[model samples]
Target: MDLTVKIKRYNPEKDDAPHWESYEVPADPLDSALALLLHVKWHIDGTLSLRKSCAHGICGSDAMQINGENKLACSVLVKDLVDDSGETVTFAPLPSAPVIKDLVIDQSRFFEKYRSVKPWLINDTPEPERERPQSPEEHEIIEDATKCIMCGACTHACPSTWADPDYLGPAAMLKAYRYTFDTRDDGTEERLDIVDSPDGLWKCYTIFNCNQACPKEIDITRWLSALKRRAVTSSASTAA
Candidate 1:
């Protein structure tokens, strides 16, 4: 199959503003959007630039707006996304982030939000003397949230993040909920504190864009709902 990819390009040094550039390329059933990007860089246009670490979608480097939705370019098959009109792929950097160049955004701000929630396992005890035991029931509580690859798709798709870039966004909130709900974690109180702020959980409007953009199928809204419930219940308990 043949494809026509229209990429929105921006270069502070050259162009006065962002513009679109189209390229025609070959496609196949096994072809990924990332593959088309590489083809563009190699054969169509060498100046086109994008980030991709693991072409298998583990690194989350190639997240971009494909046909209006934030998705991992490495994970989406061109054939699946193409309309009946055939191969016309639209590409752009993740929305709401400063575009560093074509198909690349300054991810520092995104990472900062991720760090604000302290995305890590925090337990009080030292290394387990023997083995840390957790039943499937306990582990299952946070299993969905743990699937996050930090792709920034959820963050990019969020309207709150678009309006207020400082908002921690759904990705970070989900990450916070991951540890907050973990049975082995001892930092639920602190994690809740991190998300209880104005820019944290309170900012989410429950639009569910994060849940829609998640490639891992993580129920971000569900986790966030649970967190909100815990917050309300905890406050009530403390008042009692």
Candidate 2:
């Protein structure tokens, strides 16, 4: 089927503001939106700009607003986008961030939030001769959170983050959850302090938009709720 892809385009050197540019391309029904994008760039316009790597959805680099929702372009099929009365598949850069060019948004702020949460393990204990041991049950607790690829979809979909850029956002909160729940991590209290502020866990309104946007299908809202519960319990215990 031939699909019309309407992409929002912006070039800082030329255009004062972003504008829409449409392209018609022949595509397999099973072809992904990323494939369609490549076709447009390869066949139609070489100047078209977008970011993609590992086109298999593992790298999370091709994230964009597809047909109104934030998704990894490589994971959305063209057939899935067409309706009973075929509509054009629209593409745009992720919301709530500065657009660098066509379908590419600045991610520096997102990474800064992730860094604030300290996404790595902090174990002060002496290194084991072999490796830090963990039971199957312990690993299971954080396995889902560990699946996060830092795609920024959840963060971009978050209304709170859109309203207040300082809000830690779902991606950072999930990272916090991952490390806080880890059996070997010794930074739970410090991490908790980082997320317990106004711009952190408390800012989440439980809208669940993050869960919908996540291509990894991680229940970001659930993890954020769990983090809230842990924060409350920790505060109560400390007071006592």
Task: Give lDDT tens digits, candidate 2, residues 175-198.
Answer: 999999999999999999999998
Per-residue accuracy of model 1 over 113-188 as CA lDDT, tens digit each: 8888877878868898797788999989988888899999999999999999999999888988888888877887
Q: In angstroms, what RMSD does candidate 1 have relative to the true structure?
A: 1.4
Estimate TM-scores for all models.
0.95, 0.98
Candidate 1 lDDT at 191 equals: 82
TM-score quality measure for candidate 1: 0.95
Model 2 residue 84 lDDT score: 40
Computed on alpha carbons, the lDDT of every model, listed in order, comes to 0.88, 0.92
Where model 2 places Cα greater than 4 Å from the true spot, the runs are: none
Error of 2 at 218 (Å): 0.4
